[model samples]
Target: MLLAYIDEIGQTGAFVSPTHARFSDSPAFGYGGFVIPAEAAREFGAYFNKQKRTLFKNEIPEGTDPNRWEKKGSDLLFARVSDDRPQNLRVFRSLISKLDALNGKLFYYAAEKPCGTPKETNTGPREFEAREENAMRETLNRLARHADSGKQQIMVMMDQINEKSRKQRLPVMYAHILGRATEHEDMRRIVEPPMHIDSSLSANIQFADWVCALVKRSIEYQLVPTSRYSWIPKETQLLRDKEIFTFESKLHLFHRAVDDICHSRILLEYRPVIDPLHTSTMNEENRKNLSESGKLHSVNKLEQPTNHAKAP
Candidate 1:
């Protein structure tokens, strides 16, 4: 069996419209994390803790409380150049190397948040949660495939979310999805429901936070094209070389995967607002086609909206 620790990089709030001021700040949303064999989970956590203590021993204040001893990814990766740049960079690289040697795999799903009115958006009349659910579904599906290939099942643990609705209801939502996934392999490979754990207790979840931060930073660099964060891109290149880091630069196109399997690509769907006249014309054409084929079904059921619809 494998254990996967999942974390999110950006917010999944109900702020899909560009008119919202905060939309500009976080135009993209991401979900990612790392997966390792069950046996390796404990060893990796212990090794990571030891590495942190040894590498940052000098930075720790004398007699500092053990609970306060924390090294966050944001501070380590985005630190100012004057703040132990060489040492911190070395530690970060060493961490990545250790993860690679341990056979940890990284997977993620990211998308540009849908903008415009409900009808104009890729997902008509859907809230931001829908967009997040789509990403989650895709990620879980991939995890299912991975588990099946290894002849093992997977259990997922995510960093705790404080929101009552999200924290309590997300498990139920995932259960419903997995329950209805009769045609997919997720039902078999993903045996256990996703469990939430605090980052302080689960070092694996903390590592996932680091992976998510790195992925989000890489995507942000592409969106803005700035030279200030040169280290991010460099580290991202190393991540791609080491693990199964996957990225979706745009809808319907994927990059940076270990294997570029065409059949595994997620088909992106785009929906434009249809005018009344055009809708009527399409309906008429559909009826004509159905009549020609002696079938009463006028519209394509596959084209109709389903729970699997995702943002473009």
Candidate 2:
């Protein structure tokens, strides 16, 4: 019964940006995926609350903000930091520290390109369909490999986007993944949500909070230097899609248990820097900086109008 609840944060459609050299019409998009074990949900709530108290002792004070007090009791905390250099450096460092304490792993994937771009020879609906299918396949393939060896069942729940549309599409996506699994054969079950919850509160907020934590952790992981001892390669994209499915399935249940108690709103408070030019370190010429030729061009060059299909 390992279940993985999945949700995406960030806009998926078009955006307006005039300064770029390439596709002037498209928007920048990002994607994320998070997982946790079913049994650890409660423990995470308790531990998260304690960490909140430690981080924002001054903000909590004695008895001023009822919401703060309520959050403490509820075991919820939210915080955000921008992508600015020193600030992100500190924030990401702290995030890694918290992740170390939780002993869980986070995996994320993101890709951005111009909107209205067609895939293959498809146009409109067909194009969108192909792109979505490809994205789903890529994500599933990457995630499914993280599952534990003994488990063959993997349930995946995603935030229902128009209930009807998602309901119809999710099963298809599930089936598609299963079909793809023929090559691996380890995956046995696939589940999608609105899975039941016994708690009085909505799982959306809890899931949202969890997403915030994951986003912070992911950003931090990307920003900070990795040590062989501290890094969890298992959590990274090394495993097959079947394995990742197990990991995500377990996380789904874990989030449900903590949804009621955790302070999910903390994610809203986080100030994420949107500038692609920003770097994690203060060093002007650090090769790791986002401004480096390799990194920036990888994302930016993809947007060039020269790459666009010529109009008939």
Instruction: Tell me the alpha-carbon RMSD of every candidate.
Output: 13.3, 13.8
| TM-score: model 2 vs. ground truth | 0.46
Q: What are the lDDT figures for the candidates, one per model? A: 0.58, 0.37
Regions of candidate 1 where Cα sits further than 4 Å from its true position: 13-25, 58-68, 79-84, 115-126, 166-168, 243-312
- Model 1 residue 158 CA deviation (Å) reads 0.5
Taking the tens digit of each residue's C-alpha lDDT, what string does model 2 give over 22-55? 3232232223334445565455545545544555
